[model samples]
Target: MSEVVLTGVVKRYGPVTALDGVDLTVPAGALTAVLGPSGCGKTTLLRCLAGFERLDAGAIRVDGREVAGPGRHMPAHRRRIAVVPQEGALFPHLTVAANISYGLDRADRRGDRVDEVLALVGLAGYGDRMPHQLSGGQQQRVAVARALAPRPSLVLLDEPFSALDAGLRAGLRHDVREALRADGATAVLVTHDQGEALSVADRVVVLRSGRVVQSAAPGTLYREPADQWVAGFVGDAVLLPAVASAGAARTPLGTLPIAGPTTDGPVTVLVRPEQLRLAPASGTDAVTATVLRHDFHGHDALVALRLADDTRVTARVWDSTDPVEVGAEVAVRVDGTVRAWPATPVPAPAAAADPRPVHPVA
Candidate 1:
């Protein structure tokens, strides 16, 4: 396993900057996920590391070796970084065994190596099958096995599970994560799927536009996002407008304490619906609102509430909530730590000494 590091890494496509000056470090033996909306720089960042694209600026290093920089750009084959892209891109004519074995060095070809990768990827006996003969999930497994065949120190996966159906995707995703961990491989996965990124990565880097927005453990990111963009991008968030007087924000939901880096007079209060609890209005700090619309998703229900002033807030309830019906009055209370005002940009490793504010997530 190897630690992957990038410093001032950048890439541009004509007028569009595919990647800005991004600096990050993926801990050794850790599965790091790059997450963002479509058109963000997530995939470009991965391509720079994989040597699939040349950078206009900055450096990329794997383990302790420089892979890209001034006069030092290494080619993909020589970098020893394996990539499993979205299409799997398996050779149609090659059987699973041949495809996987294609990566094995002549010296390492012995001792059931072919069987080993297939077994590791849960396609043990399917090696003889051609790519077209296998199911989508099976073919994807072969793709993974083929990448791992080289036993590279670093692996990069770009939306590798998109082809599989929902049920199979979930199972195979977990299996693939486990397999990567078992091999002690350092991996970086790039995807737009929040659940996929959250479920597998040891740490997640949420990107926006062409820069890194926030990189944190999944739970920390979900519980307390660095800004509105990271929070909203990863999952559902309820943003409410508020007026700040002193240190507290006054909403129709009563005056709630808002903590932030800077004091902006009028700003938005960001909170997750799960943090809201319903209670009687008179006795609590809760503000009253009327339920407008609600949706029940299996075990959880999302209720959209409109206050007397017409401001809306969404609250998530487990099961069908008896809190209040449509047009019925109810009190809303904030229970967890949430950003009360505009967010300050987070700093990156490249700017560790510079101390300038990083770009905010848009």
Candidate 2:
């Protein structure tokens, strides 16, 4: 296993800068995921770590050994880092066993290493099958097996499951995670899919505009985002302008407790869909809203609503059987403490129309 460290990393192409003074530490024997939108430098970061691209500035070290720095550049082959590309780029003519044994030395090729890696990826008895004969998911498993056969110090997976179906992708993710854990391999995954990053990786690094925005464990990142932009990007958020005093914020949903300390002033409160509770319109203390739409999933449903003041919000209902019809009057109440930030300046048109504004779903 290897711990990779990067400090002040920067890369540029002509007038455009891809990476900008980024510092990150990937722990040993853990899966770290780099997540961001397109053109956010995720691929550039991975290439720098794999020794494929020269760093314009800063240093990269693996296991306390400088691999890329001033007056020194180690080639990709000598870095002991393996990469699994998007498509399963396996040789069509080579059998499963032969593809895995291609990277091993002549002496190691003749040993049982290929069989060991095949078994590790849950394809023990199908070594003689050709690439065309295997399913897409099976082909990806072979790709992973080949990357692991050489016992690399670090493995980089570039959206390996992006091409598969949803069911297949989920299953393959679990299998690959298990295989990496069993081998005690340190891996880095680069993907734009938020769900994949949140579910599979031990640590998630969020990048935006060539800079690191946030890096934390999945649960912490989701529950406590650094700012309103991050809160909206990670999950469904309802942002409301309100006045905060003491420890509560007064909003369209009535008074909601704040998660942490805040000065007495205008604030923007973040309420997750799951935190809002709905019931039949009843008591005077509850805020009433008309259901605009109901989207039902197997496990839960997202109910869109418009308040008496024409502010829209969404609530997640866990009870799938109790259907919420459109145009139904429902009483809304907050279930828990919410995150709050200092209020941002509203746009001129939006501020002129309403003194208190509610942002749409993000």
Candidate 3:
């Protein structure tokens, strides 16, 4: 019955507001990843839901029951929830089965339950083995198995695979998400890895400055973000100068008719590296740029271009395509249409507003 929901949830820590106000809904049996940079309150939000931290204001509900509100706060143990922290946090003194079954309070059905969960996590027959005896990835899998032993309605994973190597992390992410789904357990994963969130989450909730930024499916959030901050956080983006008035956005690509209603004024264009291409010469909007720097990342080559205006941009192209070395002349073209987002109107230094392709991420 636990369909997790949070409305206007806020957490304050000694004059510093950790979570401004967060509203989210995790549908039953679905996995949601809370994604954001460090210190963005993703962990704070998860902790509040896990009943480890008290909320200063707002409501938290599980299974249509209000656990945290104006005057009511539920204790962590009574919340019937499980939290698997980053380091696995396994009990050093206990065997793998003992660690997983430590939370079971009702019955002494530990033997069958432990065996079932172990097999479910692909760690069958490792009951007597101590947590320290297992490999890092195996230990993580054991931790997940332990969280599921008690059969909680929801599982809170705080960067559970952050410590594993890249390859192991990827494999564990898939296996863990599948195991959770197979058990019909709702999960909330808190992580800073964009690829991790995009790959395993049924939906992603992004937070910034203690507030919920954007919440949607992985592809939707990546392709069409709610704002510039969301666009940048969910994936890599290039915000170019553009004009939008009435309905259409006059962009370097072409005049694209508007989708949603937009304010009439100057706006910044948002383009992903995948949406740009290097082509033959064209007119004014087709920028004349010199390939400044490039890097080969196996499947794709990241090419940095310095436009005549001195604006630097990074474009991603397949390695199979022709290579463009540094100092080569190239005309960068916008593949399709780009969205025009209103610029943040706040006073700032000129250098702070400088746009360069600083980070090229997958």
Candidate 4:
């Protein structure tokens, strides 16, 4: 296993900067995923780590040995790193055994190492098969086996499952993750898929515009995102404008509990759809809302609602719940801790507006 560390890493192309002052650490034996949209520097970061791209500034180190920095840059071949690209990149003319053994020394190649790696990647007894004979998923597994045959300290997967169909990608990614774990190989995966990163990685690093935005465990990143941008990107969030005073924020949904260091002023509260509940608008804490629409998605439903104040909110309900129809009046209940931030400035409200009863949904 190897620990990767990048300090003040910067990469540029002419006037365009792909990575700007990025600092990150990947723990030994743990799978870390670099997640971001396209052109967000995730791929460039991977290339720099693999020694394929040189850094304009900062340093890159693997297992405490400096690989890229001022006056020091190691070639890709000497880094002892293995890479699996989007496609399997297997030689059509070579058999699985020959491809895997290509990385082994002549003496090692003659041993049972090829068989061992094939079995490790769940491709046992298929060494004699040509690359073209295997399915896409199986071919990728062979690529992984080939990368592991030499037993390098680190492995880099560059969207290895992106090319496969959804169903095939899911199953192949599971097997690939398990294979890497079973062998205790430290891996760095780069992808734009949020589900893939959250499901398979021990740590997720979100980047945007050539900068690291947030780095945390999957659950923490999902539940407690750092800002509005991170919250919106990580999952579904309902943002509402409100005012904070005396430890509570009075939002359109009514006064909700908030825990954060903020002075009295306008704020924006973020509530997840799952945290809202619906029922008859009779309880003192329930606020009246008209069901605007219902989106039934197999296992659950996304019910859109408009409050008496005209603020819209969405709730995710299971199909097992009582059916709700459009234009139906219901009570909305807030069910969990509320996250609030300084609200963006808006124009003043118009005079002579209709007055309506607003109740707490807590």
Best by TM-score: 2
Kindly provide the TM-score of model 3 when superposed on the true structure, using C-alpha atoms.
Answer: 0.89
State the lDDT at 241 in candidate 1. Answer: 67
RMSD of candidate 2 to the truth, in angstroms, is: 7.7
lDDT string, candidate 3, 1-362, tens digits: 36998999988877667788788899989999999877778777877887877889999999898889899899887888888888887889999988887877647453588888888899999999997799999999998888888888789898899899998999999999988987888899988899999999999998777888789999999888888777776677877666888777775545655556578778876888887788755665666788888788878988888877777788988753667878988888777656667767422211111111111000
Model 1 lDDT per residue over 1-362, tens place: 89988999878877677788898999999999999877677767877787877879999888999999977789877888888878778878888888888878786667587888788888889978888898888877887888777788788888888877898999998899888887778999988899998888999998777788889999988876877667677888887667776777766666777765547577667778888886555655457888898788778889888877888788888757454577777777878555765534433322111111111000
Q: Which run of 10 residues does model 1 get worst, by summed lDDT?
A: 353-362
Which parts of model 4 are misplaced by more than 4 Å?
283-285, 319-323, 344-362
Of candidates 4 and 3, the better by lDDT: 4
RMSD of each: 6.4, 7.7, 6.2, 10.3
Colliding residue pairs in candidate 2: none
Say which candidate scores most in lDDT: 2
Q: Native-vs-model 2 lDDT?
A: 0.86
**Rank by lDDT (best first):** 2, 4, 3, 1
TM-score of each: 0.88, 0.93, 0.89, 0.89
Instruction: List ranges where model 2 is wrong by over 4 Å.
Output: 345-362
Give me candidate 4's TM-score against the actual structure.
0.89
